[model samples]
Target: MPVTDVTTDPEQLTMTLTAEFEASVDRLWQVFSDPRQLERFWGPPTWPATFTSFDARPGGHAEYHMTGPKGERSSGRWEFLSIEAPRRFEVIDSFMGDDGAPLEGFPSMRMTFEFEADGSRARLRNTTYFDSAEALEQVVAMGAVEGSTTAMNQLDRVLTGLREYAQGKGTRVEELSDTLVRITRLIDGPRDLVWQAHNDPELMRQWMLGPDGWTMTACEPSQTVGDSYRYAWAPLEGTEGESFGFEGEVLVVDPPRRVVTTERMAGTDGPSTINDSVFEEEDGATLVILHIEYPDRETRDMILATGMAEGMEASYARLETVLAE
Candidate 1:
């Protein structure tokens, strides 16, 4: 899935969302540059959007209207502030009137979109800055979180189509058995870089995090067979938790090739889940195949119900950002 995280901080007067795509940075950037593609996923599925004008360069403008299922239209405008092709851009987003003028006395936000590349994968982070806490709360109260999440979900589907079209191959998620789930994707990076990103502690810390404001405070990766590793995560403040983390034992380690490990969740004495990651290089990109095996069907279903896929997607997205740097 493309969208992995969406967060709102009233005190900070900001909202941030992150997404991952199975495409190169330049390819993923087109979704924002091309008005037609932007409109396709810019709004919630229930509210289709149409763009009147779009100029992606700095000092350019974009205007669009999203029509609700009931035929109500919400007009929006973006005044581009800065632009860096295939990487980052900033704009001021505001409500607009039928005359293409920004509405007064309404919340206008400073929005920045950063596109980061990881081999053949891309990560996008959007940060929206509000004028004040009240302004931030206003949008949150207006269902911005729920709406953005839905819209981003639609973006993921659109990205999948783009990936399939570009590579002539589609990513896959399969339920191999009652207790196993398999995920496969072709990433545009050499096998060595992909392997290093997973094995190196510093590189792992860069992307193996949960979401915004959450970090992997401790990381110990033993890349050799029969070794153990531990990683701990610190949650955002006031999130009703002290800290939670996980540990695992490495079973097999083959450089730039494959790794097998059994992950054990902290605070739980349940069966440890086994993970096998295989990397294959074709041309210049790497094909990643990951198999996750649970102890039983009930355990697999329970973890799936917890939305683990989103967290995994977020982690992978962060990895893209790290790789880009």
Candidate 2:
């Protein structure tokens, strides 16, 4: 709606819009718990005023009435297709005639929402599915596709505002999968600066937040194939330290070309849920690749949809600034 580029393939139509909220994901979740908040943004300006009878539960109803631009009112019922509490919600939306009349032709859509987070970053992805290609084509023709995207973009803005409003909130990410997120930066400085920034705790403290305001407490090399160490975090003063351990066999540590740590960040050690970081030279700069491999499939999908990328990007900016200072 705001002239954003739309990229489509045979499988999906991808429209990405970003907003940086100072509030955490946990705070954002509360804002969506109410139906009133939802309808305020879900309606189009041309659609006449509306109200919703929402049962925000599994197998419940989310019914509403809409006044068209021409003053024609229409009614519809949406049944909750699936739900995973505060993390995910899926619904089957069906349109009907003005009264309790028989159904007309409108694609039945399965809409889903997924939540993910990094230290201070959070991502939420909404995906909807149509039964078939003809169904999709029909909706596109009726302008439903574009209209829905507009609604989702509005929803994004609402969530972002909620997040920024509650800055006192601490970071608590519900990652569906292992590590669930990655951290990487496109550094313009020389190789030494990039490498040192990653390895130095002070530089990391400028960006990566551990648990509560905790920074990296300790990191040591037990280096070799199948060797690793533990890092501790103390977010608040007078709190006991929390430690997470990693033991990884070196896959590659060829200096500037790349460095790989089989280190797992979300689950028990071993190759189970490993994180790999790679650095490559690009015009005297470095293109860093940060990847997290999780053991679960569902978690993987949820994590990818969450706003991890944007969070990582922001931290990278901080890292560069810290190095320059």
Best by lDDT: 1
The true-versus-predicted C-alpha distance at residue 61 of model 1, in Å, is: 0.8
Cα misplacement distance, residue 123 of candidate 1 (Å): 0.8
What TM-score, computed on C-alpha atoms, does each candidate reach?
0.50, 0.42
Candidate 2: tens digits of C-alpha lDDT, residues 31-97: 5556655654465433322446878777888777665422356677778877676566777777767
Model 1 misplaced stretches (Cα beyond 4 Å): 162-325
Candidate 2 residue 11 Cα shift, in angstroms, is 4.6
Candidate 1 residue-wise lDDT, 266-310, digit = tens: 667757888877665656766666778888999888877776666
Q: Which ten residues in a row have the lowest lDDT in candidate 2?
A: 165-174
lDDT of each: 0.77, 0.54
lDDT (Cα, 0-100) at 58 in candidate 2: 78
User: Which stretches in model 2 have alpha-carbon errors above 4 Å?
Assistant: 1-23, 160-325
